[model samples]
Target: MSIDITLTVNGREINTEVSPETTLVQLLREHLLLTGTHVGCDTSQCGACTVHLDGRAVKSCTVLAVQADGSEVTTIEGIAVAGGLHPMQAAFHQCHGLQCGFCTAGMIMSAIDLVTREDDLDEATIRKGLAGNICRCTGYHNIVKAVQMAAGQMEGRGHE
Candidate 1:
């Protein structure tokens, strides 16, 4: 069966019909065409499908479309401002946090959530905060650095 849902995505209000079994990730990528939220692992083991649901990070694959009804969703494409990169995205680019770029979108989404919700983040804390997201490329040194850098830039932004 199909159900109608209304949600705000990337600052736009979207109303559509989705199957009861449709995941948020599928609603995003296949229906809405927001492919930035990748689908690395369908089982939610990998955080590549992460996005912000009501201002918090969530694995989109784990969230059904009905659960996101009447909610606000932020994908990687939504985080950018005025055609420029978000602070976290800029930090990732500056710190060389990604290779192959498969997991970059989810990493940035999680990092933004971590920095916004926590304070005085140390390397260990950053590592712990990002434990849910996995990067198979580098040793995560650069990812940690990128989170730290973005944390500074986003210090007073208060969940942007």
Candidate 2:
């Protein structure tokens, strides 16, 4: 059976039909064609498929498409502004937070959430918050630095 669902992705309304077993990642990637939200591990052990659902980070692979009905979803594609990248994304580029870039999307999504939830972000705190997202190529040192950089900028700019 197929179910009709609506989603707000990248600030645009999307309407589609999906099977009950279809995951959120499948809906975004296959149906909507937002491939930036990578699928590294289908088991959700790796946070590569992370996306923001209702302004919080979630594993898209673990969430069913039907479950996201009427929700606002933000993939990496949605993170940029009209002419510039989000502060968090810029920080990642400046800090070299990614190597292979496979996990960069998920890491940025998770980092944005971390900055939103925490008032005081430190190395240890960033590391703890990012424990769920794994980077196989680059050590987390650069990732932590990127999060810290973005955290400082996010204080005045606010979280996305």
Candidate 3:
């Protein structure tokens, strides 16, 4: 049976009919045509399918589409606003945080949420905050730097 549900995605409202078993990752990538969320592992150990559900970072692969009814979702595509890259995205690029780039989308998303609403940000905090995300390339050094830089930038902007 197809289940109908409404989800606010990337600031756009979307209503979709999906199977009860349809995963949020599939819903975003297949149904909505938002392919930025990648599925690296089916076991949910890999954080390649991370996204924001109702402003909280979650692994979309572990969530069902039906579970997102009436919820707000933020994918990587939504982060860039007005043709400008988000601070996290820019930081990642500036810090050379990615190589294969397969895990970049999820890593960036997780980092953004980790730094959001945070007052204290340091290398340890950023590293621990990214504990959920696993990256094979760049060895997490640049990724951590990117998160720290993004955190500083976000903190500075919080005052403006």
Candidate 4:
């Protein structure tokens, strides 16, 4: 049987009915048609399905649609604004943070949450913060640089 679930996604309220076992990644990609949140591993180790739930980065594969009811969810599609890309997005582009692009969105989302919670963003902190995410293409060198650049940009914008 389907269960009713309501959530605020990308600043918009969404109401739908899904099975109790439906994962947030399934809902975002299959039901809602927001496919930016990728699912690389079902075991929650890849971090490719990360999204912001109530201002915290979470693995959408590990979260059920029903569990996100009434919470605010932000996928990669909602990260930018009317003017241009979010700082992290721009930094990823500028710093060549992504290779193959499979893990870019989750990496950015996790780094965004990390910087939002801290004032000092250094290489070590950025590495530690992004430890949960894995990227095979870049070897994480460029990814780390991208996060550092984005942290500076976000700090300048007063996002934290």
Candidate 5:
């Protein structure tokens, strides 16, 4: 049986029917065609499917489509502002925080959540905050730098 769900994604309201077993990641990539939220692993061990649900970062793979109903979801595509890159996105680009570019979206999403929630961010704090998101490339050194850089730019902007 298919259930109808309504949720706001990437600042757009979406209404659709999905099987009860449909995951949020599948709904995004398959139904909504928001391919930026990658499904690296179905088991949620990999944070590649990370996105913001109600302003909090979550693994989209672990969340069911039905669970996201009535919630606001933000993908990497939504983070950009008016044809410009978000501070975190810009920092990632400037810091060379990605290679192969597979995990960059999730990493940036998670980093945005990290910067918005934390205060007085330091290297260790940033590392701990991003522990859930994994990056096989760039060794996380540059990733940390990107977060640090974006933290400054994002300050007082209240990016969410």
Candidate 6:
């Protein structure tokens, strides 16, 4: 049987039907066509499916679609504005944090959540925060730098 769910996604309220076993990643990527949230691994170890579930970073692959019923969900595609990118996404691009770009979306989403929750961010904190995300392209240095840069930008805006 299909379960009816109502959730706000990327600032849009959605009413959809999903099976009990349907995952958030599957709902976003397959059903909603929000392909930016990736699925890099079968295990939930990879943060490639990271997204903001009610403003907190979570691996979408690990979350059941029904579990997020009535919750707010934000994917990588949701963070940017019309003309400019989100600060974290811009930092990732500016710092060359991505190589193949497969993992960039999740990285930026995770970074935004990390920076949003933590203040006075540094290299160590950024690295520790990003422990869940794994980039096989050997781009950790740039990723850390991007997080740091985005943190600084977010801090300048004075919104914790």
Each prediction's whole-model lDDT (CA) = 0.91, 0.91, 0.89, 0.91, 0.91, 0.89
TM-score of each: 0.95, 0.95, 0.94, 0.95, 0.95, 0.95
- What lDDT does model 4 reach? 0.91
What's the C-alpha lDDT at position 149 in model 4?
88
Better-scoring candidate (lDDT), 3 or 5 = 5
Candidate 6 ranges beyond 4 A from true positions: 155-160
- Give the lowest summed-lDDT range of ten residues in model 4: 151-160
- In the range 58-121, model 1's lDDT, one tens digit per residue, is 9999999999999999999998879789999999999999888898999999999999888769
Local accuracy of candidate 4 as per-residue lDDT tens digits, 42-154: 89999999999998999999999999999999999999969999999999999999889999999999989998887777889888999889996756999999888888778
lDDT of 6: 0.89
> Which parts of model 5 are misplaced by more than 4 Å?
157-160
What does candidate 3 score on TM?
0.94
**What's the TM for model 4?**
0.95
**Alpha-carbon lDDT of model 1:** 0.91
Q: In model 2, what is the error at residue 120, expressed in angstroms?
A: 0.9
Candidate 4 total steric clashes: 0
- Tell me the tens digit of each residue's lDDT in model 6 across 13-110: 99999999999999999999999899999489879999999988999999999999999999998988789998888888899989998888888988
Clash pairs, candidate 6, are: none
TM-score of 2: 0.95
